[model samples]
Target: MGIVNVTPDSFSDGGRYTDVDAAVEHGMALRRAGADIVDIGGESTRPGAERVDAATETTRVVPVITALAAAGVPISIDTTRATVAAAALEAGATVINDVSGGLADPAMAGVARDAGCPWVLMHWRGHSRDMNKLAVYHDVVAEVRAELLERVDDAVGAGVDPRQIILDPGLGFAKNAEHNWQLTRRLDVFVDLGFPVLFAASRKTYLGRLLADAEGRPRPVDEREAATLATSVLAVAAGAWGVRVHDVRSTADALAVWRASGSPRLKTREN
Candidate 1:
């Protein structure tokens, strides 16, 4: 999956594709770069980012999704609001990538059921503005898995098709650097849950901290592509269903190399 942030304040590559035409072109570029799906988000879910009204988010993302879908690109609406998801689906989006994991809106599950499309349930404790304060975990892996299962149960109970649900560990949403690495290291556990797992660690702050400079300063966002590629390769190797990334071509190249090295397990498969 490739990311297309149509908001002005996403942590990485925000404001670069807010225009409908630019966003459509970028989505096409991602498709050309070998992305199976292009996820477009109108709201900035970056840590400490403020929320956008539902109408504004719908306005920002609908036209882009419509254009991309019209051009034959697979599109996922990256939003938590049911109204926004409904509008994007009406505009031709095929998937809903809800970072709130059905917790933010009571109507999200119904929307997914009505649309009959895949819904990505990311592990989230709260909204972005106050999410950092909710990052408490004793055993990060165990807790995340358990929480994700709870989400699954809730979504299933809410009438979402079990087969259409995908799980995302939501790296850096409310997690600290340690928690992020811990989740990455234990990715297989999430994969073992019998649901498609989406690893979205593209250019996040945790990677920057991991690749800190000699002076201990975190690496810049653009400089984190190497780390992001490494994470994508490792995630694929660990049986993750997919990875949501900003730099699609580099990740595609890395995956090709990994497969060419004769690792049958690294062959891409749908989860």
Candidate 2:
């Protein structure tokens, strides 16, 4: 998946694609670069970010989704609200990537089931406003895995087919820098839930912290492309079914190199 943030405040490359035409053009570019899906977001869920009203979000995303659908590009609506998902699916989005994991809005799972489209459920605690305080975790891997498993059950209970569901570990969302690192370290844990895993660490602050110089100042999001690509390659090697990223061409190219080697199961460093 390639990311197209149609909001002014997404953590990375937010304002670059906010324009409708530009968003469509960027989606096409990503498709050409080998993105299996283009995820378009109208709301910025970055930590402490404000929420955009449903109408505003719908307005921002619909045009782009409609254009991309017409262009025959697979599109996923990255939203937590059921209303937005419904609107986007009707507008031609084929998938719903909900960071809230069916928590933010009660009506989302139903929407996904009704649409009969694939849904990507991300592990989430609270909304971005107070999520930092909620980042506390014990045995981060087991806890996240267990929580996501429960979410899978909930989604199934809500009539979402288990087969149509994909799980994401919710990187950078409700996770501290250290927690994010732990999740990265245990990226394969989510795959045990018997669902495909979507790894979305593109330009997150964790990468910035990892690549910081001795001065300890974090690198800017835009300056973390190398780290981002490296992390994506690592995640793919760790059994990720998909990766959500801002730089599609580079990631696509990197994955191509891995694919040419037969893209078999990833071996651990120890192996």
Candidate 3:
């Protein structure tokens, strides 16, 4: 999966693709670079970010999704709102990548059920505005797995097909640096839940902190690609079904190398 943030305030590559034409072209470029799916997100979910209205988000993503879909790119709407997801699906998105895992909007499950497309349920404790305060966890890996299971139950109970469900640990949302590392270190815990797991640690703050300077300053977003690539390769080795990344080509190349190294069987089912 490749990220296309059509917002002005995302932590990484925000204003770069806010224009409709630019965003669509970027999606196409990602497709050419080997992304299996192009994820289009209108809102900036960076920590402490405020929510955008549904109308605005829908406006930002529909045109881009429509154009990309027309050009034969697989698209996923990265939104927490059911209305926005429905609108994007209508515009041609084939997947729903809801970061809130259906907790933000109750209608999201119904939308996923009706669409019968893949639904990515990410582990989220709260909205971006207050998520930092909710990072408390005695055992990050166990808690995240249990919470994701609850979300799985919710989706199944809402008439959604279990086979269409995907899980994400939500690296930054409601998670501290240690929490993010713990989830990645024990990614198999989520993969063991019998659902495809999406590891999306691309250009995240946690990675930035990991590569911090001696002055205690976090590394810049663009500089985190190396760390992101390392995480992607390691996550796949740990049995992640897919990885969401900013530099799709680099990650794809790395995965190709991993595959060439014998394409060994991983812990979880390969998609």
RMSD of each: 3.0, 1.7, 2.6
TM-scores for all candidates? 0.96, 0.96, 0.97
lDDT by residue (tens digit), candidate 2, 112-141: 888888999999998889898898887888
Task: Write the residue-wise lDDT of candidate 3 on 1-271 in tens digits.
Answer: 9999999999999799999999998999999999999999999999999999999999999999999999999999999999999999999999999999999999999999999999999999999999999999999988988899999999999999999999999999899999988888788778788889999999999888889999999999999999999999989988889999999999999999999998664564334
List ranges where model 3 is wrong by over 4 Å. 263-271
Best by TM-score: 3
TM-score ranking from best candidate downward: 3, 1, 2
Q: Supply the global lDDT for candidate 2.
A: 0.89
31-58 per-residue lDDT for model 1 (tens digits): 9999999999999998888998999999
What local lDDT does model 2 show for residue 1?
Answer: 98
Clashing pairs in 1: none
Query: What is the Å distance of residue 122 in model 2 from its true position?
Result: 0.3
Poorest 10 consecutive residues by lDDT, candidate 2: 262-271
Judge candidate 1 against the unseen true structure and give its global Cα lDDT, from 0 to 1. 0.92
State the weakest 10-residue window (summed lDDT) of model 1.
Answer: 262-271
Q: Global lDDT for candidate 3? A: 0.94
Hey, what RMSD does candidate 2 come out at? 1.7
